[model samples]
Target: MANASSMKIRVEELESGMITAENVIEPGTERILLLRDTILDSVMIFNLKERYNVDEVYIRKNFSAATVADEMRAEIDIHQSLSTLKEVFGSDEDKPLTEFSKEATKQISNVTNELITSLYADDNILLKMHQLQSYDDYTYKHCLRVAMMSVTIGKSLDLPRNKMRDLCEAALLHDIGKRTIDVDIIRKPGRLTDEEFEAIKKHPQNGYLLLRKNGSYSEEILNGVLMHHEKYDGTGYPLKLRGEQITYLARIITVADVYDALTSNRPYRQPWSVAEAEEFMMGGANTHFDYDIIMAFLAAFAPYPVGDRVLLSDGNKAEVISNNTNVLRPVIKILTGENADEVIDLYNDFKYLTLSIKCLDKDGSTGE
Candidate 1:
């Protein structure tokens, strides 16, 4: 059944370019089959009915007037909600179990709901969200970022609606166990002792126990929270599960979680540059991460985001105006030198093979 603001129709009746209003769910589960705002074509419609056995889909009441602002609002709402949750949780250090459980469920639900609503609305929304971030609260912002990225990867893989929701919830709450750890250890400004590092590794189990004690979340969700830290190379924490032993949802969250952690600023180290983070993930492929999921993560990000000033191999400076189908290459609009104002399509031009991005143009300097 569709929500009151949306409508439902059989997959057979879906037309090309009609936007899905809600995530297409697998029957009787939280897995997401297709994401909302997915513009359906004939093949997709066929696949929905045949390949995945999706019967009907929910669609927004109107798409004619949809704008990027709607997606922006959803992003803002998530940040605001997370901020509120932080305040509520911090108000009383000795708050009851019911209080922690209640607020945790409410905030997870709120954040994931916003993620579901705005995920497929526009490809640019996540990039825009990144630009709007403030580094005040690492846990709240980091969890939300991981949730969005995990959902993006899930949608790319065509995960069922129910599984997608589960993935989102799992990723969003994966760090909830940090609440139980000593604040001094969790927020330490310096590198930790070996004992403290061991304490840090206990978060996954602590989170799993907390959620299980809450008595509301599913076993799958608990497993996801418990195992997201397990490595593909058989070297992670707690039980040290490896390869296929880890849950698939945890596998997806692992990639997103590590990527955000590497790229985000922490007290002990400066944030890795985006290029550095991407390279690090690729290098760890098949070792720290599932290879296929890493490829999907690669596809989800633009190394040089749109609007960045870049120096080209051909002695020209340009702005990344838009992306092409390739994540590494983009359509650049030249800003200086012989090709000023020229729109260069790196994926198409024959000479593009000989050229590459030299560096990002920073204030009066070029940055790698």
Candidate 2:
């Protein structure tokens, strides 16, 4: 007889004669043994006795835990940076654009580089980055999220370092013009009136002016600010540059902007799920967004995100344990049956079982 601690069972090893335990049943112990086929619901554990009969039972396997502390720390740092930006922007005293000073820019740039390096070290950071809240300081948070998301997508596309930094800077300053807009309109919880929206629409041009006024930013950076809103189909605002006419940095920032807008909760409505937001982008592909950038964005993002619990197609609850080798699907551990507390590698087994993620449970932590 195998010792409970060392006992290993394969999926194929499960059979009618096997007796399972509510927990990890030790050998030579008097724990109740539950029949395999008697299991019901999903992702749970049950004890069975020797007299019980079985036909079929689902058993969950164990999965390794993913370390997400660094990811969470990165998220907190990003949020803090945004908060600082808002405080600096909202002061009653008008600091001249020239007074904006290059030191702060240098500090932001250094932080950006550190953040990119941290995120690249762990793919899990991408999901945690998405969970950042858009507070009253939406402008700063929006800029940071855009910069991070753009860097993520750009790196996935293998853009060179110089170009990626340019993209990051562009994303960071994409909404600098919002400083010139009325705060009430920018933060209004309801649908904007035409005039209000028109005011909001002027941000791109305003941002371009502000950056040019500083006289420190390059034309590449300024162009990114002016054209980030341009759509692939020429339906977007400002200059309405179409498709390839939009700078690559602008195109990248556009996707990031749309993604952050959809995922961050607003006073008007709750944020969309990561999967839902990605689907929205899919619907807009080739029309509102660049197709390849969208693809790269999808590859770099976790729809369900690690650490979030989800209900599986098999009617079981599982925690996302790790990202799958394939970007679209993640590996989850069954947390609820005879398989309760076991890890399931959906990527390896579900191919034959036709299993897929059914729904996400919002209650669980995204683990770090």
- Ten-residue region with minimum lDDT total, candidate 2: 35-44
Using lDDT as the measure, the top candidate is 1
Report the poorest 10 consecutive residues by lDDT, candidate 1.
Answer: 91-100
Predictions in order: lDDT: 0.73, 0.66
Model 2 clash count equals: 13
- Compared with the true structure, what per-residue lDDT tens digits does model 1 show for residues 45-155? 887888878887766556563544544444456557577556534532443223246666776777677677667655454653453233457777777778888999888
TM-score of 1: 0.69
TM-score of each: 0.69, 0.65
